[model samples]
Target: MSQTATILVIDDEPQIRKFLRISLSSQGYKVLEAATAGEGLSQAALNKPDLVVLDLGLPDMDGQQALAELREWSQVPVLVLSVRAGEADKVLALDGGANDYVTKPFGIQEFLARLRALLRQAPAGEAAPALVQVGQLRIDLALRRVSLGDAEVALTRKEYAVLAQLARHPGRVITQQQLLKDVWGPSHVDDSHYLRIVVAHLRQKLADEPAAPRYIVTEAGVGYRLMG
Candidate 1:
């Protein structure tokens, strides 16, 4: 089913577009291409592609603007492609509605892996399950509630967002910058301490032993993963 997913690749660079078109098409995906943001949006609306590959630098419109505009009308997942590798740029793209960001000169293998993960976590058309049981913790995404065994757990907005993000991916190691951007917005991307604090709070709430958490495992300087 993943191989059959359609993707729209939007970039001003003909070479990049050609490369991705061939690469993705060879993998069994129906690839659509557009040279500008306007065309991309038009194609998206018309085709309703399963995923979008958007370039940040567009001649007619900024990539962030396009993401925001598309998000206003559709919840289709968007993956940003940009020359800018700055944490700030990544944060802005993610905060503006991009599901993921990849800098230029990216390895094809890494890019493909990221694409797969993003698609795997794409929201389903039908309603999601109200109760999500992962390991020893139970989460009610609809009600924004959590429980550990028989005890009700309390979590802050940020903590819940972090936990939910991890829950969405299960074993995936979500980067610190990505979590920061997704949970705290673009402005707080540089503040790694914020993630630490929130993660600690979440562990305290969900883990029997905060120091040796079973569900929320830290990946040192990398990120956090939810071990199911």
Candidate 2:
């Protein structure tokens, strides 16, 4: 997929943009760059890149604002980069609409891994599978049915929503905010406890232990990822 993929890099620092352009280009990805938020937005609308690499500190606008604006019209995957390492900053960005967050001064390999994970969730000119199999679980998205082995596992509406979201992006981390916004509503993004309660119920029904999860893997303060 990298061979024909396009990635947009929005960062003010010349060195940062240059480094990303080189790194992403070397991986057979077409790289588009913008030094300002406005330019990035324009590029994103016009070119419609597969993924975006955004920096929080921008000359024209705050990266979070840019992200919110982007989310309004587009569902493109966005991987945010910031100098701030605080958990709050990460949570805010995730809730604001970022697909993933990576701290500054990050390793190129790890960055590439995160980028690939986000790309995997992007539409690839085909519809997602109707049936997703993960270990002992089977999810039939079209019918909104979930089964473990031969027995059907009944789930609440919210529980099914969360599981389906995770199932769709198996192995990719879905932020609490993203899940809340997608499942509950935008106003409920900050209500992490609502998600926690739902997840607890799901774990109980799925027979998944929080100590060593076999399906839903918690990312602590970040979010959750479904592991097959």
Candidate 3:
């Protein structure tokens, strides 16, 4: 998915744009930069990025105005970033069609996580199977249930979220950051210990051993992939 996920960074600050570009590039997302509101709008229309990281304080115009104008034609996901931490400002951005609001002084992990969340799955419309079969485990995405060889696996919400995400993409390698962000939220992406703990618990429930994994296989210093 990252091979071509272009993210537009709309901010007046060159440093912010550089920071985002570097961070996002490391995560394999293609980065596009715009320093002003008009440039952002023009870039959005011209490039049609997969996701947008927009700042509320643009030099030429307010970010909300750009967002509103954007809403008139596109439904692309926008993560509004601003120094304005006021609730009213957040509400205004959200109401104007922004998908999410992140205040300035945000953690890079969290910011990346929000972007991952926005681009996590395709617009949810395609019908998936009611039950997914992975080895002895059967996942019912609809009923919110998972059964392993006729024994229902009782899992916490976080556990289930992680498993379901991996199950949905059987052979794909989900990055540690992606899984962490998806399961534990953005702020927890860099907390590898937390992910390890959860994965350990999940493996225990699934009767899986890390050394000879039949279910979730650790990709060593990278991420995890459910054996297909």
The lDDT, on a scale of 0 to 1, for candidate 3 is 0.84
Q: What is the lDDT of residue 154 in candidate 3?
A: 99
- Candidate 2 lDDT over 118-190, as tens digits, reads 9988866633445678789887764568998899999998999899888877889999999999989999999
User: Each prediction's TM-score against the native?
Assistant: 0.55, 0.55, 0.53
- By lDDT, who's the top model here? 2
Candidate 2 Cα outliers beyond 4 Å, as residue runs = 124-228
lDDT of each: 0.83, 0.88, 0.84
Off by over 4 Å in 3: 1-3, 121-228
Question: Backbone clashes per model, in order?
Answer: 0, 0, 0
Per-residue CA lDDT of candidate 3, range 42-90, in tens? 7876677888899998889899988876764456789999999999999
Cα shift from native, residue 224, model 3 (Å): 52
Candidate 2: count the clashes. 0
